[model samples]
Target: MSTPVLGNNKRASCGPGNGIRQNSLLLFLLLALASCTLVAAQQPPYDVYPEAKPPYYRVRYEASGKPGELIFPVNYTVWIPPQCETLRGVIVHQHGCGEGSCKSGLTGAFDLHWQALAQKHDCALVGPSYEQPQSADCQMWCDPRNGSDASFRQALTDLGQQSGHPELSSVPWALWGHSGGGHWAGGMVMLHPNRVAAAWLRSGVPLFEANPDRKSIQPHELPEAALKVPIMCNPGTKEGVTVKDGRFAGVWPANQTFFAEVRGKGGLVGVAVDPLTAHECGNQRYLAILWLDACLQARLPETNGHALREMSLEDSWLAVIDGKTATAAKDFDGEPLSAGWLPGERIAKAWMQYVNDTNITDDTPPSAPKEVRVVDGELTWAADADLESGLARFIIERDGEFLANVPEKSQNPFGRPLFQNLQYSDTPVQPLTQMRFAIPDGDDPQSHRYRVFAENTAGLKSKPAEVAP
Candidate 1:
């Protein structure tokens, strides 16, 4: 082998020891650089998001107990991703009692609503099915202590432990459920006020009414601490009255009283009463999205008005594309919707069904004959009367055939007057009609399956009214 030349340097050494030492040093330096990069990547840019990942994690867990003696087979779907700089937090979904314990049909019903939230808001969603025993005393369908609630809570805890994603550790979370599930959600919110941030109760019984005047009704009683959070009391107008004797008790006034109590405690309570829908995931899906955005997006404004009062009609609300309220100037109606209402530019095109769909507007007109017209490629309607006078009821009709009606009971935009925990001396209001429905897109306006009607206290309803195409 030719001798290696050392030009103006130390003698060149090809010894195995020197070669090995140089290689080792090079490898060590490479690893150190890689380690530094990893550490930097793992560090979240904000305090809320301390991890390198999205802040939430989806998971499933089981209850550690026997199967028959009130053992509820729970199917938990958890969502709390890593690295959430945004305050929009987690929301847990509780499924209604259906079919068997841990069955797919019952759990699948929640997928649409839960998945929508997860994809839209970048938040986590956890859903659990409560498996009630077949025993006569432990009917899982309606029993509060039938292990459903406990199973869900356990899944939440287990998910938090396994997923090293730090956000679920103490982030704000809301409980939402429908029908039977709504019952559980309400109980959870009342029972664990400190653990849960707030709740959205849909078509469920209020806790206090289970045993009025009983101090033991602690779960239903609103706590002072809960005032910091919110609980949206939403009931579908088309839920068909509470059936007692094969007949409808109509909308229970007691439910309104419960809302009043929660509101009286300075809690955020939004009611979408008499919406253009019924007790289905579609209704919950739309409402829950808005509710979740409100609860987790950021701080909302303080209202000096009655918490149980209806939102105004004179206001043109604005919000983020995701429907979160922005801090903007209020409208003439004193509504803050204009502040944070941002519509997604491309959403209208992508989900034209939502935009084109003829749904009920939360705004109710002042006492005047309302007119319907399709304006600027949007189905728009205008009424000149206050909501209470019945001159502006949100009516549902199809193809000139009367379908349903949501009568107005007050001057408030939301129709019904705010029950001030006391009776209203003025005209215990009665709605002109109670049927509520909506027209779907792709339906013919002239021969469409449904149309909306507006009537005044005089029982005079609009004629051949159709929203703009």
Candidate 2:
């Protein structure tokens, strides 16, 4: 089964168009990426082992996509925590090479294990199968196009949407895979680091040969910043059997090579070497969750949230705001609070709102160009236009001038939020005029400073605001 490629009609088009046209083209490309084939209309609840009496189980919504095309069907299994309201995190299980079978394949035993894990962690587990090939053709296994990265992503996305837990957005996620699934886990770490918080690979093969250029250009290459992400490799003590000539052949290396590679790159790599164990699912899983618990317990920095440094308009700098002790955020609403109010405070509302919208960008211009203002207890800008449509880019200006252009689609220098479809959520227009930014907080609040600017096509820039400290 192959990942789904979107129909041409679903794609964007352009013919000698301007910035707006170009932006549309970008949107099209992003949407085309949605071709990931993990589509199964969620079904009503049902029992898995209806006849099993009190200890019952069921994979509620299990269905393949429209038949015909290379159908890489992924099963979406939900492991609801006993206390759904107070959830810990999301766990994703990627299946390895096997013909589709819930009983005999990776999906079978994992469904039970995932459910147990979810119960233990007070979270949810979603196991998705990325085309576990029935045959191991060298060409097929080696081809990047043949991999299940897209299907895996789509599966995770579908799970998130259906689970309907707002906390999932905040909760971290761990990627677990065995054998071929492990290889895909590596790909996920390299390609979608922003979507995953950590990963554990159990006896998986290296899908890609390590190359310097591929390391740099490959969309899935591990980013330098991702060195912080935790990784684990639990290769079986015994070598895995290599299939040859349509038969199970010789054995391969039992060493934890990928574990070493990840460790070399400054990642926290866990290794459960040769523990008097056989090459089976049970052993691999034990190592996976043990590593998960350790990594998930750490308190990570809120790189993009409210706890970060604040931005000030004075010199286009970001500062940290320490409001930890406040019952609720101190109100700088109607009445201006001293020290925190920065230059771009006027446009801060518009900028922040644009970034947080969890929907596709309409790519339209703001209708009523209203300046930023603090209304009620929160900051808000009353723009008459469709504020959500315009393009947004983060401007890193040293002294009221452009320094480097950072596309929002750029990797989150951290390993969390793997498979992040942040780009798909909002279509950003290029050459933005008026811009807003959040201020970073720090131990010494006075040390940070930054400003926000709104630029127009006439080369006119909006007055910078002193971001509230």
Model 2 CA lDDT for position 150: 42
Clash count of each predicted structure: 41, 59
Q: How accurate is candidate 1 locally (lDDT)?
A: 0.38
Model 2 score (lDDT): 0.35
Cα displacement (angstroms), candidate 1, residue 204, comes to 0.8
Instruction: Report lDDT (CA) for all predictions.
Output: 0.38, 0.35
Model 1 misses residue 174 by how many Å?
A: 1.9
Please report how far candidate 1 places residue 212 from its true position, in Å.
10
**270-315 per-residue lDDT for model 1 (tens digits):** 4444333333333333344555554443322222121222222222
TM-score of each: 0.45, 0.43
Candidate 2 residue-wise lDDT, 51-132, digit = tens: 2111111122223443422233334444555455645666766544433211122122223324545555565665442332
Instruction: List the candidate 1 regions with Cα displacement exceeding 4 Å.
Output: 1-70, 79-88, 100-113, 119-122, 133-150, 166-169, 211-219, 240-251, 274-278, 299-469
